[model samples]
Target: MSYLSQITSPTLLIDEKICRANIKRMSDKAARHDMKLVPHWKTAQSHIIGDWAKEYGIKEVTASSIKMAEYLCGQGWDNIHIAFPFNTLEIPKLNELAKTQSLSVQVINPVTAQKLVDGLTEKVGFFIEIDAGYGRTGVHVSDFGLIEEILLTAKKSDKLYFKGFYLHAGHSYYMPDIPALYEQTRDALGMLKAKYQSEYPELVTRTGDTPGCAVMEDFGDIDEMGPGNFVFFDLMQANLGGCEKSEIAVALAVPVVDINRDRGEILVHGGGVHLAKDVLVDENGNKNFGEIVYLNEYGWTIPDHEDRSYLKSISQEHGIVKASKSLLNSVQIGDLLGVLPVHSCMTADCMGAYLSLDGKWIDHAEGCH
Candidate 1:
């Protein structure tokens, strides 16, 4: 039987056209800026997808963990950046990765820096993570003086190579509008880079965050863009004006489990196990699980439901839809419901594989324990 013909109920369908388009657009954006696009593979954890990126001229890749770094390295990917902080516990494994693969690790503190230098091996490269505007990991931008200290400290051993500086404007994702995020990211990186250039004229500036990299036009100070989410545009990205609805590549194909006409609700087999609890609410704080886009074979339309609405509620194994009376009355058991996830990363992480819209069962995602 063909892969699509074998797709059981409640499959994970990805639109191939949209996925390719997203990759092309981000690659084009990085090219226009004269910057290298090292997309975070943590978003789409499949080597198959990584191969797709490689075909688009993306040579370098980023991951969230040392394990992912090792896996990607073994799969013939040479340049790998572990975007997370340096964990002392994984020092041995990290050392091995560095020795075997072209590895770059992100470190934000003097303590980790000291540990790494003490355990110095010739394989690893380090990026001084400066907390530009994000309150997350990375040394404070105000601590520009420490960059030289970290470099000098690492230089104690010939084993370490301090490549440059890296930052993630994660705070940009919290902004209400993309323009506000763009201004905040631009100014923050600008000030941070100026301080760095004053101290270390030859240092490179690496910034990665989908919101900032996708919307900002000024790449004057940045040496490279490290956006991973741009490869798979989600509803959150859409809301942030990063991409259009046509650009969204992933979706959850849920099975209709129950219908309640009196209450105007439809239950689907897809729950937190498939769709996750990602939602966006209004000023009144009303939550939406996701949006119901289309139905299969049953004219079981969700009345008054459009791509802009939300999925409302989800239990461990069930998704609740808040629909109008007429639409709820038509839902039947076993009907296929096409739901757009609010966040593609969270949703894809829950699913173990992807069932293509063209009816191909593609093995995607890394089995993270």
Candidate 2:
């Protein structure tokens, strides 16, 4: 049977071949730059797909939360790092999970550091989170006093081991000049690593933004690259020039429900609930929920630029596709149309599981043990 015969609802379709290729590309990039590719599992949160990464020698993985770390540990990952700021309340859970695997957590404040020191039974490594310019979390790069305070607080307990610094530099996702953003981050991290490497001789630096990790060839002082979204490049990454549209490994297979030729639009059964609410504003100042692609026997292909169609608007369970004349004529009601998501990470989390092109059901983190 064809792959489409297994589809009944809006499903996330993963092209495993394309996904493996993207993995190999990133793995090769890490080898060339002499950095460890500790990919974040927040994107394709599937142990089945995670096996593909292991084929490329990625033994260590990054998780977005303690819960994610626990899930990864159950999958037999020996070394896992939780990239989110340390949540002291989850210390009991963290301690339990750390006993089975080499676990690391991100700490932005001394208070959390002390909590870890007081509560941690099993020794766990801590990365001082640095806010180079992202302003989301992490201590400011120039706040040497705060940095020292956090480090000193953590050092009070033998249970807490310092594991250098972590920076996400999230602005690279929207910033037009990635090289400039990366340079500023490199300098800030380089300075921090230089100042403290003598104290902690085994110190390492890690960067976690997909845009910077995907595009930049030169990783100055960064010892580890922890990007998640590059595994399934979304519409946002393609717009930001991180990857070509063809490299997007996952697409939403939404069944067409309506054809509105009068308004030159088509409607699908996919919306915020399945695609997430992440939207990208195009160069023409229009909001785009997802970009449309067509499915075939092998997988899917990006539509011709001259006849591009995209999900211009999305509600809770409905998607409105702004279609060109050629796009409008291409499909009918009840047909399955592929959509490249705005954010692959969020979309994958929302969809919960995947239907690979080879007709296998892949389990993801959502709703899994």
- Candidate 2 lDDT score relative to the true structure: 0.90
RMSD for each of the candidates: 3.1, 1.4
Clashing pairs in 1: 4-359, 289-312, 290-311
* lDDT digits (tens) for residues 57-133 of candidate 2: 88889988888887788666767989988889899998898888899999999889989989999989989999988
Residue-wise C-alpha lDDT for candidate 1, range 1-369, written one tens digit per residue: 333345456676777777878888888988898888888878787777787778889888988888777768766676888888878788888777777678888877767788888886656778887775668787876775676677777777667676677878887778756566556555656776676576566666677888778788877667788888777778788777888756777767777778776767888788887877888776798787777766443212332534233467888888888775545655577766677778887788789778765565566545652
Each prediction's TM-score against the native?
0.89, 0.97
Candidate 2 residue pairs in backbone clash: none
Taking all chains together, the TM-score of candidate 2 against the true structure is 0.97
Backbone collisions counted per model:
3, 0
Model 2 weakest 10-residue run by lDDT: 360-369
Q: After superposition, how far is residue 207 of candidate 1 from its true place, in Å?
A: 1.6
